[model samples]
Target chain A: MIEARGLTKRYGGKVAVDNLSFTVRPGVVTGFLGPNGAGKSTTMRMILGLDRPTRGTVLVDGRRYRDLASPARHVGALLESRAIHTGRSAQDHLLALAHTHGIPRRRVDEVIDLVGLRDVARKRAGGFSLGMGQRLGIASAMLGDPGTLVLDEPVNGLDPEGVRWIRDLLRGLAAEGRTILLSSHLMSEMAMTATNLIVVGRGRLIQETSVEEFVRGASGNRVHVRSPQAGELAELAAREGATVTYSAALAGASSAAAASTFEGAPGSEADAIEVAGLPSERIGELARAYGIALYELTPRLASLEEAFMDITRDAVEFNTAAPATSEGTR
Target chain B: MNETHDRQSRDRAPAASALPTPAAAASSRQPGTATLERGASARSRRGSAAARAGDAPSGAIAGDVTQARVMRSEWTKLRSLRSTQWTMGLAVLLLIGLALPLCVSASENWTVADVQAGSQDPVYQSLAGLLLAQVAVGVLGVLTMTGEYATGMIRATLGLVPRRLPVLWAKAAVLAGVTFVAMLVASLVSFLIGQAILGSHDVGVSLSSDGAARAILGAAFYLTAIALLGLTLGALIRHTAGAVTALLGAVLGLPLIFSMFGERLESAQRYLPALLGNAISSTSPARLTDLVSPGRAFVMLCLYIAVLGAASAYVLTRRDV
Candidate 1:
């Protein structure tokens, strides 16, 4: 387990990580999420004691990282993929680290095979591709089989299969009671892999919540309903404790799935009202109670991507407008 | 915040499958607990049991990062690099190769007038290649630390042993040991071969001759000290080109710049590493008149190593990687 209390890092006048305090407990994958300039990487470094905190302390298993007898066996971190001598072979690089703490030579070969780098174990690290370099880094982190694993962008340069492989590896390790903290900007990947999320924006904590709550809390539950008596249905839904907003041609203007779902319906061109804080089934039941003809009632559950965007909207460091293009440009 | 607490509590529930396997956990013993050579660093700690708390986690027995293990790791690192072999080979070659031509030319030009007039010190001729060979050994020393920073391997290295200073210490120890052994052999071979050629003219100093053995051993110490200085500069600079340049300037440039001012800076010239090196290998009293004795020069070199070595360690612990 890793606990950081009031961890702060500042370079010159610019703060990288500001008063960040969090606990990474074993048995779950904690996703560290942030925008490009956020302090996820800096926080990880501080936890590993690579970069000293400007103020505050980080502990691995209730002690400073430097105080640990064998830091690698308590906390194994993959800070950068290419953090190996390019001129040395993969086996030699791992062996060099393994030699520290007197870890046996067999364990070196074991981690090499564990990361699926056996084929290229003897090849120079400089020649390894990005995926191979990442594998080597993972092997290095797992060399000591520490209780805590901190990885920064483990899937940055991975293929689909490699990404899936890493996801499974992280889950399996977490299932085995390891504290796995990984950072990534990919919302979909985190949604699939992370159990809990520690979201940050511009070096400050935005929210720390489970993946399920993060999505459910950010975007309110909204339901879209179409009816032949659109005006009356809207009034009834509004009166029944649901905020309703009417839309025309929303079927074509919104998602394509929403448009296709109501195609060729009896009230396909009828007016529709978007109801918030109400389930689709309740809307359907209300229409039935009022004896109103309902064409469609679709509940729009917000995706994790939308939730991330909503929470980080104000925290984004670089905001850009859409570039203007001349009409004649192909 | 309440939800976060709730989620954290839920996460705390024991994960049966996630727990470390009994076998793998059992292998996590304190690093040197299995070995008898517990290393000087282990005993230096306040209490081994208290430090071992972080290493032992009930079923898990993590290894301890003893200084001995770090030294072994440093040896592995230094030996595994292809550049180590190339540069060390170049140093050995320069030491012996340049010594042969210098001895042969000195012997051909040797006359009673040159020897009686004390124009050329035979030991100096035999070890003249040290000036050129130092560059090779010094660059290797610089690369030992800068290569890690250049490749970003220092993060992984420091992460493994976060005390950070031990890494620097182990590096210095390894470089000193390697350079001493290798350069000693090189110095011996160069001296013997150069003496064999000079022996034909009866101008060669035997191993038993006054100051001859000291000069040869002193040259070895001088080169080893140069390598140590390289390691220190590498740590201080943390950049390959900058550290190498700084090391070169201290060893060669400072002495040349000091000598160019002639008598004005004569008092300070003897303290420079290169001038001290010159004093270490020169056996003639005439040459010693302008500089301190070899013993004083050895002490001066030690002072340089201690001061720079401590400064490097200080910056290592205080600075961010």
Candidate 2:
């Protein structure tokens, strides 16, 4: 288990990680989700004691990482793939690290085979591809048979097959009652592999929740309806305790005159409404009672990617302005 | 905590069931399961040993990171690099190779003025190659520390041993120990060969002669001291080109720069590393009045190393990796 409390790291004038706190428990993979410059790497460094926090404490299994005896045996970390010396061979690199804690040479060979790097184990690491470098990093992390694995961007350079392999590897390690903390900028990847997420934006915690709850909470049971009398149906749904909004394309044209013209209009393709806090079945029934010709009634569960973007939009470090045409309608 | 655990278990069930195919494929295609099993067995053995110890609250294992282990790790790292072999080999070569020419020419052109002026003191003349060989040894020492920073390997190294001082101490110990041994052998071989050549001209001194053994051994000691200075500078500067420049400027350039000031800085010149090294390695009676005693020069070199070592240790622990 890993615990970070009031973890703050400031580089000169800029604060990288600000008062961040979280707990990573055993038996599950916790996805550290953030934007590109949201201090995920810095926070991980602080946890591993690579960088000293400005004012905070990060403990692994109730002790500071430096204070832990044989820290590699308890917490194995792969901070960056390029941490190995380029001139050293993969086998020798792992052996050098293993020698620190007196891990046997046999263990080094085992990890080399485990990571599927046996073919290039004796070649200089400088010549390995990015995927191979990541494999070597993982191999070194596993050399101590650690119980806690902290991996930063583990899938950055892997092929599709290698990505699948990492997912399975993390799952298997977590299944063995180990704590696995993996960081990524993509929510779709975490949606597949991680059970819990600690989302950060602009060096601050935005939310910490289970993936199911985050998806469910962000989706909010929204329903989508397309109809000839969409404007009237929107008014009815809004009056019935559902928050109704016109779709971006149709919102500009949803005046009273257009609503009246759309009523009984057979081929009005641009009339649609998004109804939150109501199910599609309820919206369909309401449309039938109002005699509105319902064209499409579909329950829309927001994609995890969209949910992540919506929550972190303001906190995005390099946000671009919305298009001028859509700005007035939204 | 209990609620979190319950939620975790509930969450893990679906995740575990969702990836049956990939997990099975991974195991079938790779040596995944057996490796994990072996890891589990090793962990169990370590866990049992920790339990038996009963004294370590942090589950300290038997072979946890120690000074000795770090030293051993440093030895592996030092020997595994091809640069280490090249730099050390070059140092030995220059130590003995350059000595041959200097000793041959000095013996062949021996004259009455050279003997009167004490320029033909066989011990100092034979060990003249130390000037160039010290450069190679110093470069090796600087690379020992700066190589990690240049390649981004310091992260892996510091992560392995979070209590970082042991790494610095181990590097120092290993470099000092190895350089001392190698340079000593080179010095001995150079001294013996140079003396044999000088003996043909009836100007050679035996090992038992006054100050002869001291001069030979002192050359190795002076070179060892230069290696430590290189390491200390490397730690302080951390960049390869910058640290090497700083090391060379201090060791070789200081003496030349001081010479341009004439007799105004004559007293200060003797404290420079190059001058101190020359004093320790020279047995010429004619230059005795201008140079410090060998013992005093040795003490001054130690003082320099001690101060630099303390600064390095202080900076190493406080700075972030």
Candidate 3:
């Protein structure tokens, strides 16, 4: 378990991680979510005691990281893939780290094999691709088989198969009752792997919630209904305390093209109404009672990505005024 | 790309199967306890004998970050790098190789005017290679610490040993120990070979002669101190080119620049590293009134190391990785 209280880090005058407080419990993967420059990496560094906090403190397993008896035995961290010396071979790098805690040479070999780096373990890390470097970093983290794993952007450069492998590996480690703190900007990935999330924006805590609640709360329950009588159904749903909006094509046809093209396009297109603040069941019941023939009724649950975008929209640091393109006009 | 993917997938097949067995075994063993801790304790209970025999189960041995372990780790780190080997090899070569020509020339040019002016110290002449060798050893020391910073390896290192100070101390200890042993051997060999060449002209100093042994040992000590200074500067500056430049400026530049002052800064010149090194490695006692004694020069060099070491320790612990 890790607990950080009022953790603040300021580099010169610019605050990197502002007064942030959170708890990461054992037996589950806690995703640390933030945008670029939102201080996720800095927070992880502070937790591992690599960077000193400007104020407050962070404790790993109820003790400061530096105070832990065997720090690697308690917490294993992969701060970055390029943390290894480029001139040194992967095996020698792990061996040197293992030697620090008297971890045996066999354990180093085991981690090397576990990470599927046995083939290139003796090669210089300078020659490694980003994925291989990431694997080596994970191998070093697993050398001690610690109870807690702190991985930042573990799946950054991974292929689909490698991404799945990491997800499974993190889940398996969590199943063994280990606390896993994973940081990433990929919300869909977090939705699949993380059960709880601690999201930050501009170095401050925006939300600490479960994956299910965060998604459900950010986007209210919405139902979509397609019918010949979308106009009448929209009014009935609004009277029942539901906010309703017609689909763009239907709204356009009803406003300007209703009299001119209504008879021409009759039965050719189905008018759809999007109902919010009401469940699909309630909308179906209301539609049936009103005698409005509903051609289709479907519940639209917002994806985690949409929810993340909605909540962090104001928190994004680099807001582009227009879509960026590579072309430059003279 | 497709072929590499196929190869990587084939490589990952066995790894995927191999990973879950340990997790399952760990969960079955105690559920929440760290698997490695249990394995380490079991291995410890099984005794170091089995561990030493290399037949203990594939598990981590119970250990914490200690000074000795960090020193061993630093030793492994130093020895495993190609740069360490190259730099140290260059140092030893310069220590011995450059002395040969200087000794040959000195023996050939030995004149009564040199003896009359009392400026010719055969011991110091044979050890002339130290002037170049010290730079090699000093660069090695700077690279030892700065390399970690240059490669972003300092984060991994500090993460492993969060106490921080042990790493600096260990690097210093390892560099000092390796340099002392290597340079001592090189110094001894160079002195012997140079003395052999000098003996051709009947101007050689024996090991039994006054200050001869001190000069030989002092050369090694001075180089070792130079290595430590380089390491300290590396820690303070944390950039290879910058730290190396600073080290060169202190060891070589200060003495030259001070000599140009000529009598006005003569007292200050005696304390320069190069002058101190010359004083420590010279055979004769008090050749000049302003020159420090070999013993005092040794102590002064150590004082420089101590002050820089303290500064490095402070910055190391207090700074972000």
What docking grade does candidate 2 earn? acceptable
Candidate 1 Cα outliers beyond 4 Å, as residue runs:
A226-230, A235-273, A276-298, A317-330, B1-61, B112-119
Q: After the best TM-score superposition of candidate 2, give how far the Cα of residue A109 lies from its true spot, in angstroms.
A: 0.9
Q: Give the poorly placed runs of model 2, Cα more than 4 Å off.
A: A219-221, A224-233, A239-262, A265-299, A317-330, B1-62, B112-119
**Selected candidate, larger lDDT, 1 vs 2:** 2
List runs of model 3 lying over 4 Å from the truth: A226-229, A236-271, A277-297, A317-330, B1-62, B112-118, B286-288
Using all chains and alpha carbons, the TM-scores for the candidates as numbered come to 0.84, 0.84, 0.85
Deviation (Å) of B290 in candidate 3 = 4.0
State model 1's lDDT.
0.79
DockQ of each: 0.29, 0.34, 0.31
lDDT by residue for model 1 over A165-195, one digit each (tens)?
7776776566545678999888899988787
Candidate 2, residue A88: the lDDT equals: 88
**Residue range B85-151, candidate 1, lDDT tens digits:** 9988999999999999999998998974665556668887898899998999999999999999999
Clashes of each: 10, 0, 0
How well is each residue in B1-321 modelled by candidate 2, as lDDT tens digits? Answer: 433322222222222233344557466432334434533543344434423444422222225898888898899889888888998999999989987898888888886467557876788878888999998989999999999989878988998899999999999999999998998899989999988988888777788988888988899999999999999899899998998899899988989999999999999999998888888988887776788999999999999999999999998888887
Error of 1 at B258 (Å): 1.2
Task: Summarize candidate 3's per-residue lDDT along B5-61 as a digit string, tens digits.
Answer: 112212221222346443443344432234334333432342334334354234334
